[model samples]
Target: MDRRNFLRTMGTAAAVAAVSSTELGAVTLGKDKKKKAPAAETGLRVRFLGTGAADWKGPDDRGEYRRLSSVLLDNRILIDFTPTDADMLPEGCKPECIFYTHSHADHYNPEALLNLGVPTAYLGKTWISKAWKGFADASAKTGVPVPEIVPLAIGETVVCGDIAITALPANHAIDATEQALIYLIEKGPTRILYATDTGGIMGVAARIAGIDPHVKKGTPITGLIMEATMGMGDKGDEDYRLFTHSSVNTVHRTVKMLLRRERLLLKDGESVYLTHLARTLHPTQAELDANLPAPLKAAYDGLEVVF
Candidate 1:
């Protein structure tokens, strides 16, 4: 009904609000993980948990929750926590580490955290200039002593125990008020950059694929998870959605720029995964695959990959 009440209610359960609201909330992702999903079956696993471009729902209404926009990494690291993220965290996938590139309706999963305790002791995404203030506000309210916001710059690293994360700037929205963050995660030979809820990176995205002076230096792209949100055109044209969000061709351009021309360092065999699809373009997975560049696939809910 109200902001405070809305936040409080979301803290209760994934479907608590849906039951009361006319427009259903997110679908529910079971809390129980099926299997450990061995490397062979999982293959650098990355579960989409909800792949809708903007609106979210339970996949198939099977009671499985789709998120606004979020990615659970290695079953612990969280790229973003939309309300649906709570529904996406199928059992055995509760995240221990959380990283927010920016604070937005979909990016900030306050309710998701309430469903699973807020990760006050992890890499938090907050303002670069007002880091301490953000931490204090969180602490003041949640009473879950906030962790260091780790004010991260485009190339700076946010180390969590053994994991190293880098935050990059991106234009978050078309309306042009909110700023967003793109993240680069590294642990040994595997490196991942998570970009969502924003237009495709234009300039530095190519450089990001190149050698980084701070990181392992020349690590090539082993795994990449991008967004193919506007795969379909607007108003059901199947070709118009291209202008608003990145699509198959857009991804091809990105890969060509990052991998083909730059010759950026990458492992011999790397898999690039794309998420955030247009509901209108419910293309067969095969059809979606045929359009992407080499080693790229559209992301789906509950897709899991190991770095």
Candidate 2:
């Protein structure tokens, strides 16, 4: 609802960015296996079900299928929806909630939304307007009423089950060519940032003020899911990209802005998962993987991760 109320609802924060606190952090590596525990005690199980998005090949491409970025947390809560081949769906997989990071065709595919009966949230104005305009067409094919369109205001938080999700205005053109959204998702003691469709990090640091500046990081966020659409090296030259998207170098600089400034954190072995890739960009999965300091991995469709 309102900003004040929303922050209160999150209960606690992870300015320190630690695990064993957020939904994503519930994931235990091979050795952490408790003397063994029950499913409930383990917490929500998140899995990467797909790693694909529209134009994975290019603008003209539809879906030849190598990857489509989509994640199913405990078989519900889809991070981004893309048109994916039915064969790629994980066995017995079904999502209950869909959170759109932006309004790009790659992130919100009309075909994919057609089959889902669950409600979805649009965290940005660009995405809200685009989806609302197409509501009629999507409803007709699905035989389901248009989804309950929840309009999220910038800096507002919503409770999804046990998770508290907040939207931060992401940098993307609101013009006809594109519409977009980015998110900061939190649960219990963990905080997770889902940022996509960014071109630079300077403005992002200024807009992400909702994150309480005092909270220690590792205590809250167990993980970060960011974009690396561009590659390494100096990005000071391009005027177009600077205005609309972030390159790998920009992403790195942004990360430093947060972690170094204590806005986010990195545990001794904790990690950062990169998703929503643009293959045409300079940062290839190999490049991001090989160059990142540590605990970083390329996110693909169907890839599930813990905070």
Candidate 3:
């Protein structure tokens, strides 16, 4: 389908459940059950189901095991999926669709997609053909029907119910022919940049994020969920993952740059959460949270935030 017609069909097909006006604040799920600063009743809700990188083996220091990376938005849309996700999915969560960042095994799982039975799945246009074949093979092996696949190029935006998602080029790569991606999510006045599995923001993504004043600027981002795959301090500078992943130092520098450019908005508490943490590299979640600068916190599995 053409872009205009494609968008219209998706917007109607994936509209979320009606939002309630009740003032339910954000709360992280776990033994501690810490609550965040109160948010507006109509704020965008993001729940982290998994926060680990490709090396998903480890209990950290606190005996907490993070599955592969994935998130549920407003409890209706999912960002990435993995087989392990079934272990931690919130009760009553019926995700309408999924938006994948890339075709990495750690980020995308065809089995989970088939099992979950979401109606549609969207991803970067560069590798959609390969994805279609993969989905078809999976459908043939199993009895379930394949979810409809939608190809989205960088700089393209689609409306799904009350949310608007824009695809942006990521600095990471799986092969010479593929285009990895990050996402820009908009709901009402709340704008969030969900960047992972990529190096620091650069190229078209920088222009879209308003990092360069010379380029046409978009709306300021009200919140951010970025990856810090490398460990604390300056370890990422000399590590091999520096090219395709973010480090603690990289996140700090990027946040400072965004603040200076007035491109990012900070909330009262923890406006930014670092995900895709490497289990072998990082310390316990509490220690990580303690070391991060104010408003920039480490995200643990099952954490919830309303922006």
Candidate 4:
């Protein structure tokens, strides 16, 4: 799509009205909300609808399995959508928006997105044109009108309801021209870092999470849902997959550094969950829990948590 057509489609008054309906009128959440507030008063609900690497394919003999990686926040915003996620959504659930991490098949499925009937889908500005073409072709085949595609650059923030979502550059690479992303989500006093399809925390994300000491610190992270695609079994720093996916040691070291810098906010003994696990490398959840260190738990397909 060209610039004029893209702008005309995305900036129309009807599109704006559809997007505006997502804004919560009565919900008021501020950064200064009392730390001691009740859970129902200051918490964001997150459901892990799918949590697996690219290699996962349905169920296995051990009765262990996972679908493609995806997350639903407050049951309104989706981090990613996949074809397999249709069966995972709650009954009568209707999401309003979707924020993509990249264009990888595991993270972005045009059919699943169009099927959701969401009003808006946010993507990185560098690849929105390509994304528009893909969505247009899918819509032609499926008879579903394409949702508005909102292009966002790194560091850009968009407000949906009382939530503020900021995009951060990811350390992963797909091709020469595409840029992957992680997100920093905030609601009231709760802040969450959703990092997936990325190797490690990039410099910009590290600075924003207050984990980089040389730069000005930003806010502390309340919860983290990160990917560990390159499992911990026998992978080392020299592994080629480490460049695009995180391993066990990588997550552990990063979390330790963040803790030392006081960049993570945990309440009532909450732990960070690891998603996008590889079926071949990582063991069952029982074995994983026995092996992983404190505050790093394995995420399952139906796991839900509040932060």
Leading candidate by lDDT: 4
- Compared with the true structure, what per-residue lDDT tens digits does model 1 show for residues 1-307? 7533542333344335323541322323111123121122222335565555654554543333334667765455577666665666767454544667566555664445644654332332335444455556655766666542344445555443234566666645533443466776655555666766546664564356453333434546556677776663343234544444566556656666567533344566756677766555546466666765576777667776666
**Stretches of model 4 off by over 4 angstroms after superposition:** 1-40, 233-238
lDDT by residue (1-307, candidate 2, tens digit) is 7533433332233211213323433322111112222224233445655543334663323332335566665454677766553445566544445677666666666557657555444445545667777766878776767765666656655554455556676676657644466666555555667666666533443345434444443233456666665544564225355676665566566566667666667767766776555555434445556776555566654555665
lDDT accuracy of residue 131 in candidate 3: 89
lDDT of 4: 0.79
Models ranked on TM-score: 3, 4, 2, 1
TM for every model, in the order presented, reads 0.65, 0.71, 0.87, 0.87
Query: Tens-digit lDDT track for model 3 on 1-307?
Result: 7655654555444432323311222222111113222333487889898999988765655787888899988777789999877766777666777899999999998878898887778889899988898898888888789987888878776555556677899889799989999998877778889998889886688686555545656457889899999888866666788889899888888888777777887766556889999987888887886787766788878888888
- For model 3, the superposed segments whose C-alpha errors exceed 4 Å read 1-41, 58-62, 216-218
Model 3: pairs clashing at backbone N, Cα or C within 3 Å: none
User: Which 10-residue window of candidate 4 scores lowest in summed lDDT?
Assistant: 28-37
Give the Å error, residue 1, model 1: 40
**Which prediction has more favorable TM-score, 2 or 3?**
3
TM-score of 3: 0.87
For candidate 1, report its TM-score. 0.65
lDDT of 3: 0.78
